[model samples]
Target: MSAVPQERRLVTAIPGPKSQELQARRTATVAGGVGSVLPVFTTRAGGGIVEDVDGNRLIDFGSGIAVTSVGASAEAVVRRASAQLQDFTHTCFMVTPYEGYVEVCEQLAELTPGDHAKKSALFNSGAEAVENAVKIARAYTRRQAVVVFDHGYHGRTNLTMALTAKNMPYKHGFGPFAPEIYRVPVAYGYRWPTGAENAGAEASAQAIDMINKQIGAENVAAIIIEPVLGEGGFIEPAKGFLPAISQFATDNGIVFVADEIQSGFCRTGQWFACEDEGVVPDLITTAKGIAGGLPLAAVTGRAEIMDAPHAGGLGGTYGGNPVACAAALGAIETMKELDLNGKAKRIEEVMKGRLAAMAEKHDVIGDIRGRGAMIAVELVESGTRDGAKTPDAAAAAALAKACHQEGLLVLTCGTYGNVLRFLPPLVIGEDLLNEGLDIIENAFAGI
Candidate 1:
């Protein structure tokens, strides 16, 4: 028999009777710190729809925080992971290395931007990959300091927390952070320092100058950044900013690291966002969508820099789990067969058109910015001329809640919490995509 269709099919209230019961049980069993985006609990998911326990099928725009690019339970990924499971689960790659792990690393080296001979090391999460990138950079350069950008998010690990720019939520209670981490202003032209138009180059140059004076280029080991700041409101650096930073790093003997965890695997309409600016970073940290929902991250970089660390210094017990590697291999194959990069570009085209229209109609939408499929809409209080004004988080949340009630799942993000991020699967149908966009517009209209 054919599988049940996966689309919006609301039978009961969002939480319903069963989901409410489950939520109560979860409250009793699960940790109190655990949080959720939507009240409905997921029972099944495929393509663009997530079937909640209450039988309400909500359109998935979050994509598990941009993890499942090919969509949840993709056929090839399921097949490959299942087949691999039947063969062997874990031999602890460190204890007895396997071909799957090596193969994924090889693929990463070839696929990640940078024409230089590259090497890769797999890890369990984005945080792990980022940490390893720093280790490699320090090992190679023998420097003590690392520079990160304002509104940039690397990870939650101690070291990465120090590297991360946000203070509350991500690093509020968690302290004392790792040392030798410095933060500089990002190239956000929308909120330029001097209110200058097209200030990307100036912003980058000023940041480089600060680094040279305040944190001496010679003392800096690496300059880590996200090409399109993910949690920082999906902010894409100005055209020349990244390339200029890369050039500065090269001239100053500092390793340039691109954190592509949220932007890689065709999500940004490119293999890596660094490719958009033709900036070849020395190291690229990736995760989220790498393994089609599996927990796999990687740090791929120039071979010499990656190999600078001693042999035993770089691995984890579950770094490149066999199952996850198999899923990654399948995910990569799926991207190629489906041409997800092209799909992402198409998504951008559609989203840009729709959102541009929405911006024209709604004064609350202060800005709509992003590249390819990775897009966001920053909402401000009504009648705000300056984009620099803090976003209206309360209004954005109300809109998101309304969308959820109306059978769509959208997520809000940003430093100020006013941006709504769109990270739908590249495979979502045009009809469904339009449907979700309609929900967003309707929510904004209601607000």
Candidate 2:
């Protein structure tokens, strides 16, 4: 069936009777540090709705943190994974390689933006892909320094943590980060020192000037960035900023890496967000939505740079696990068959329409921004007229809690923790999608 029927039945309170009982058990058994954004527990999910253990069906706007883009329990994915399971689960690609791994790499080269000769290496997570990209860049350029933008999120590993801009949840107490990593300012027009009114070219030129002066282009091996800053708010770089950086990286020996973890696979109405500007990075790191929930990531780049790293240096024990590769094949097939890029464009239309209306009605909504389905609404304490003020984190947290109570799952992101990111499955039915958006509007109304 193209659309699954959804019924929002709340038999008990949000956590419901069964989930509360399990939550208590979970607290006793699970580590305390592992936190949850929503208190409700999910038992089943399809399309865009998550059925809680307590029988309350909540619309899922988070998409398992943007991992399950094809949707939870997609039929094709289940069938493909099931068939692959019958064949064999793992032989370790490094020890005994498989066609599934090779097939996935081939697909990556074909699908990722760029008409040039491209090569790919599969990994287990975004962090692994990013680390390998850096390794390859350094090996190819014979440079030690890597430059990342401010408010960019790479991953949780020691090296990626050093590359990440946030400190509290990601880097706190995890000290002694990797060396030779540098940070530069991002073209966040909302908070830019020069302001957004200036032309995109001017803003980009200024940012490039800062990078050239501070880091010295010759010493840098790579400049890594997210086309749309994922965790640090879904801030799209100013128009000219990405092209300028890409050109600079080319002019110098620096390899430009686009971290497409949260922005790829038709998430932004395109196969890759970098395609929006026709800016091709030397390397692209992708994960989250690549495998329809399977743990799979890839670093696709120019063949020369990718081949610079020795074969043994680019692989991992679990890299390109057969099962994950099979899942990716299914996911890619599903994306193409279902025309998810069109779905993402449709999602952008709905999101822009509703969020723009919401921004008008609500004073606290400072800005509504994003491209395609990867959209976010930045909440400010006062309103949009008072400039880009940080929204009250406590209030945003409370709003999220209220949405959870009202049978809707949402996630909060941003450097200041005030932006609400909407990552609904591209397959979400219009009814359910509108219902979830309505729930958000209601929560904001209550606020």
Which predicted model would earn the best TM-score? 1
Pairs in steric clash, model 2: none
lDDT of 2 by residue, 1-447 (tens): 433347456678887888888889999999987899876777778788888887788888899988889988787877788899999999988898899999998999999888899989999999988998999999999999998888899999999999999997999999899999988777887776567655366766765787778878899999999999999999898888899889989999899999999999999999999999999889999999999899999999999999998768878888988988988988899999999999999999998899899878887887788987899987888654366576667667878888888888889999889888899998888888898888888998898
Q: List TM-score per model, in order.
A: 0.98, 0.97
Q: Could you tell me how far off, in angstroms, the CA of residue 35 lies in candidate 2 after the best superposition? A: 1.3
RMSD of each: 1.5, 1.5
Give all candidates' CA lDDT scores.
Answer: 0.89, 0.87
* Poorly placed runs, candidate 2 (over 4 Å): 2-5
